[model samples]
Target: MGEGGKRKSRQEDAPAPPSHRILTADELGLLKVSEVPAGDKWEETAAKQRWGAPDKAQGITRLQVHCPDWSSDRCLVAAARTSGRVTLHAGSDGGDLGSFRAAPPASTSGRSDTSTNAVQALRFARPEGSQQLLIATATLGGHVSVHRCPVEAALSTALAGRVVQTWEEAARLQTIGDLQAMDVSSSGRYVAVGGEGHQLKVWDLEAAGGAAAAAAAGADGSTPKAGEPLFAGKAGKPSRSGLQDLAHVTALAFVPGQDDKQVLVGTAKHKLWLYDTRAGRKPQAELVWGEGRITTLQPQPDGSRIWVGNGRGHVEALDLRAAPAKLSMGHALKGVAGSIRALALHPSEPLIASVSLDRHLRVHHAIKRGSLAKLYLKQALTGVAWLPPLPPAPADGAREEEEEEEEEEQARAAAEEADGDAEEEEEQQQHNGRGARGKGKHAGRGKADGGSKPPAKKQDSKRRKQ
Candidate 1:
């Protein structure tokens, strides 16, 4: 064959390239953590390529990771940008998956528009028996909506999903607090929102007939029944000066194992409050947490530990099992030059990821003994999350089915052989019995011919004559 023909044949015989997905905890541990990349490198690589809008100098507003299940290997990372857009990125390679505009129309000119519905907080949740992930987002304009993200969204273009339900807060923007922070419980049954007016409220989605029921309730959807929240509390301490307290909640998170009843709240007044809905509307406990506003709170799976980040550039650990939940000095992580914006814990590892106003993403060992990795992004980062691993491939399932079928075939063949052997043995036994009977008959005939049979017949005739 000519050279061109041989090259074409070789190309056809080559193996296909591997598909990229989010890195598992084990895979992340294999990387060099201390080698920090330059800020310009992110502008050229992840920022421009993965996020698709390098001009969005306004940075990200919130980040969340969605996994169909804890055991699933496939995961998606969603980042809500200040441009009123939400973008999806692959967990494995930080590649652009897809994006959609979540809030009202806004420009991408690196300007923050106060009038536009800019996304302030977002969460990824999967309801029980759901095949897709639900993204709940709160905007600065007091708008809350739930959008359904299909499994195949990664393969589609920028607009990947549709809003399943939406509800507006009737409070005026100037008087009531805008929804600044929001969280959905692990069960995806409860959602809580809090902000500037020192107002905190929790909604039981399950009680509201769940996400499926709300979707059918129309675009206006259902609101938390006429101001009656499943749980509600205002954060702030009364002042001796007779002036109104200006404390507004800055961060909110549901306690992981508390049946969606326990909540951790952080306010602009440097306080942390824990509230249990089953107990009462008042906070179960309150503690002076930080010197500045608390920006984020990440609770452990067991709810015994919580990692907190603040505007003072500190990430501290709190032992919830303690009487008052004091911050542990030994576990305090520090080094960022700017305020810590968000914190995300690894699902199964001791690693924690954080993004800050310093425009850097840093991962550290949970114990504060080692730095795992750090990368610089040119613009300020408002949020960060560790994406889960991807799910098993279709080929793996097909292979499992093939092995099961082969085992079944082998079992059937063994049973058929055993039946055939038993039939042959039975036929041989029947033939032997027939042969033995024939021999006996022949022997009797021989005896009769030798006159033994005549003597018996003569005795019978004599008896009859007598």
Candidate 2:
């Protein structure tokens, strides 16, 4: 073959090169323990009696907690799928004040077989100097509802008690099937909804006015629209170009580092499709995760890297900013494997928390030089939210001294144990040698004395002794 052709063949067959640069944990910062606690709801039931107080009641179940940013002190929302209701809890330390029942849109009621909708997605949208907005979608239903409340309200009250503004039948697309996943842009300008269909719809809340006004605008854009093309699909066409070929999309995320507005769609087939909203073009790149179905994809704040997790329990980071010729381009972070169900990046640290079907919530720190250290949770975790750092406590010199002393003591004990083991082994060797020498001497003497004896005479002597 020609030189050029031969070179091309080798390039195509060669395995991707290894990354030369090491990533250190210090570059990622230390992941300090913030808050680790169980998410549950309990209410005391009092017995109503003529002269006595009612008895207290208690209920416990696992719940999903949604905390947006690591800097936030409170979890914005909490929901239990079994209960079929979503509760808006006040900040990281606040209790649940109000709750909402997700109901199917009026247009889709003919298709409803249940009474209430299941909460599928929850996100907090904070616009510049504006009240925080709660955006949630109902699963198996076609409705996206928005609630506006004070930031402090989350820490002080329940979402159920708050007066919620609901936008029923907000989008025009009909027979929407289900609201599979949803995401609110970091800028809080757009809300993207993904469903059973192949296309994703982006809603501009500002242009839609308020909930009441936006619902009136509906899917057809009858009134003054929020902007040109109020709702644009990731793929422009609906027929052959829709999500049908991508498998069912399970997660959606806005890319953090891209200058252009871009979003990633993760499908059941472990394929990641990146779509540019401004260009309205097909995906710029496609990545296929080999282990299991991709459950989620989260991009780092800088947009330089992306974290992807699949059903088979594997989490990897793709360095999108790397040069195309670099072998680390789109590389997976090492030492992470399992069926990952969810992932969250620590807001200020170079740490990531991933939950898996195996009920493990593992914290992976990207140490310096491309190495990683992992810490596992005691039980299988379904969701994880970073709690804001609390105030530091006063220094205790005596306590520090005591801890140091204990560590030194433990080290001495280990050393002593190792030495003891070596001494025992030497003693055993000495004993074995003594026994072997004694047996050898006895055999030699027996052989020397009987060297000239005949077989018949030896047999006669042995019989006489017996």
Q: Pick the candidate with the highest TM-score.
A: 1
- The lDDT of each candidate is 0.62, 0.52
lDDT of 1 by residue, 1-466 (tens): 9755654565555443222112211111111112212331222223212433345434566767765444222546667766666666544445556566565443458875655467788887766676556777777765555666555443232223322222221111111247778888877767788888746788766554444354445685333332356778865455678674575888889887778888888888777788878877767677776688988888888988888888898888767886234434248875554788778787777777777777677777787535655567555556565543333334544455567668879999998999999899999989999999999999989987887777899999999999
Model 1 ranges off by over 4 Å: 1-51, 57-59, 68-73, 93-101, 104-116, 149-176, 206-227, 236-244, 323-330, 387-466
Q: For model 1, give the 10-residue run with minimal summed lDDT.
A: 24-33
How do the residues 1-466 of candidate 2 rate in per-residue lDDT, one tens digit apiece? Answer: 9755654554455432211111111101111122322121101111111111121111111123444443234444353232344444433233435565444333345574542244556655556676555444434564455555555555333334443333222222222456677777766667776766645667765554454465565785332322433455543223454534633667787776454377777777667666777755566566666746667777787887778887876677766664222213244555566677667776666767665666444456644313232444333344544444332332354345556569889999999999999899989999999999999999999998888688879899999999
Q: What is the Cα-based lDDT of residue 373 in candidate 2?
A: 29
What TM-score should be assigned to candidate 2?
A: 0.56
Q: Give the Å shift of residue 69 in candidate 1.
A: 6.5
lDDT of 1: 0.62
Off by over 4 Å in 2: 1-77, 80-84, 90-94, 104-112, 155-175, 207-211, 214-247, 257-260, 322-337, 367-380, 390-466
